[model samples]
Target: MTLKEATLVTGGSSGIGRAICTMLLEAGRTVVNLDYVLPQWSHPNLVNFQADLTDAAQTRERAQEIVSQYAITALVNNAGATRPGTIDTATIDDLDYVVALHLQASLILIQACLPALRACGNGRIVNMSSRAALGKPERVVYSATKAGLVGMTRTLAMELGGDGITVNAIGPGPIATELFRKSNPDGAPRTQKIIDSIIVKRLGTPEDVARATLFFLSPENSFITGQVLYVCGGVTLGTATL
Candidate 1:
């Protein structure tokens, strides 16, 4: 297998998505970053496609463009937006945007890229999920959308399995990113609490989530599909504190 095999990742401009893009590029893969914002980096193998993922037409067009321009073998749905607040306070527009970006966009892109993915033997698909989907009730809309991603992963795995494509998801817990800090003003303390409760007493880094994503997308991960692997420091073990 050559490094020219392309991996397309949405939300590659920043946060965990950026980390995932860098890792895949470093591993000698052609990386296509689909996002509304562009990253401050330059690489011949890194292809940037600026598109409003929430817009179905834009997503479909870009998906086609990526396949036409590269030998695409993987798709990573990581682009998402959040309007943090309780359901009562969350606006209709906010909820709509969340669903559009997190749920609808992924579905549209996968459908648009199916033919290309099927053509590339051993193709892979990964959805970036959240630990909040487990039991957290704070961001109800966000959690619901992420949980929907898990369902998409499983269904796609079944549908695309016969075509030699694998689908899986990764959930990150309390990652120390700028977004995380802004989302929780006292995030540091909260992160610390989560760390102390985890088997590994440290907040996870963007790289940690990226690495797990890479593992699932690797050629060796052919047998692993429909699995939501949480890259948190033992959060799934009931070790994490809210």
Candidate 2:
């Protein structure tokens, strides 16, 4: 079947990416997901492709193929990993690995999608950064790379505005996803600390980030670009300690 235009979301097998895919699918948009692991659920409008975005060549190849096949109108660079370590424990390998997936792969996908995005005359790009970007201990490499995304978002917004593309970054703060649960757990001292630190006295949700993403992806927000929306329940107002 000839597919209609679609929105491409990376790391959609779970967490915030999955939430974004859910919202887009409910809106009747075809969705393409690229992740190393397949999502647990299925939908007629949702398609999955297994991709290890850390592999630069594989990332570019799949991106080209998907953008060509899907007529991609929007791109969401949401796949990321955190290599937790204090400055003394941080390693060169960790820096390279996180940078490869978070920064390099995001650029590759955006480049591959540019042709199709520009052709559509109204494209959307949402980069999933983190509140950790502000300054999170034990996440030196992750912080550097996520902050790199914010720089990329602002620059691309300027470069792609003429193409009718709006670029934005979402800085998620303490979302209670599967991964967060595994590390923080319920009633854990650290998790409770995070909740208390937030002005809203709660952790953010994947749905919160997804909603902000949808706002950026909407044609109605065409005039809003190069912005960073922190769905962190005001965690950003304090130190980004995690």
Candidate 3:
């Protein structure tokens, strides 16, 4: 019997990541959720593997185990953390933590998954970036790591194109999730300002981001690569009151 080729997604236990996992399962794809926490939702195709991505040793060990056990055809580097602080207040520890999770972990996982991805012939890789990668206040460290992902995505697309693997990124803007609400708080002036700035006049949902991700990962999207699709409601264009 042939085993189903799986998509490995980091941080798939909650918020945008959880939404992605749900959508993939609905699309008849086997999904392996590599996260520290287990998701609340359950599906026969969804498998959860708990690992701290920030730890290099743990990441390598888990990535090897997952890739060896599963025929991983796609990888989504979606795990992230936000430390909101100005450059003056941001410490080395903050920089280290964000870089470790966002940048280093991705590098490790991609390396581990390279052989399987190559064997798949038509592989997909989607990196989870943020609109803040363009520029955002009080998120110097976070923004830097996300921007770095954009660079990595483009470079990998070029390097892996001959192998029939496409690398892309999704940069979500002002999505209303538990994490967003926790960071921005309800009724905060800054939050309202952000909502008003969006041309759609509201925040984006996790499903919105998930849909875009699936598009990039679809087998039909073989021509597209190294592109960053901003899942914002026209907010990236400019802040406008409507």
Residue 118, candidate 1: alpha-carbon lDDT: 88
TM-score leader: 2
Q: Which residue pairs clash in candidate 2?
A: none
lDDT of 3 by residue, 39-85 (tens): 88789989899999999999999998897788889999999999889
lDDT of each: 0.83, 0.92, 0.92
Give lDDT tens digits, candidate 1, residues 108-158: 878766777888779899998888777565587888888899888999899
| Cα deviation of 143, candidate 3, in Å | 0.5
Q: What are the runs in model 1 whose C-alpha is more than 4 Å off?
A: 1-4, 184-191, 239-242
Candidate 2 lDDT over residue span 1-242, tens digit each: 55469999999999999999999999999999999999999999999998889999999888877976788889999999999999999999999999999999999999888887898899999999999899899999999999999999999999999999999999998999999999999999999998998889988888999999999999778899998888899878756434
User: Judged by TM-score relative to the true structure, which candidate is superior, 1 or 2?
Assistant: 2
Candidate 2 weakest lDDT stretch, 10 residues: 233-242
Sort every candidate by TM-score, greatest first: 2, 3, 1
Tell me the spans in candidate 2 whose CA falls farther than 4 Å from its real position. Answer: 1-3, 238-242
Candidate 2: how many backbone clashes? 0
Question: What local lDDT does model 1 show for residue 28?
Answer: 87
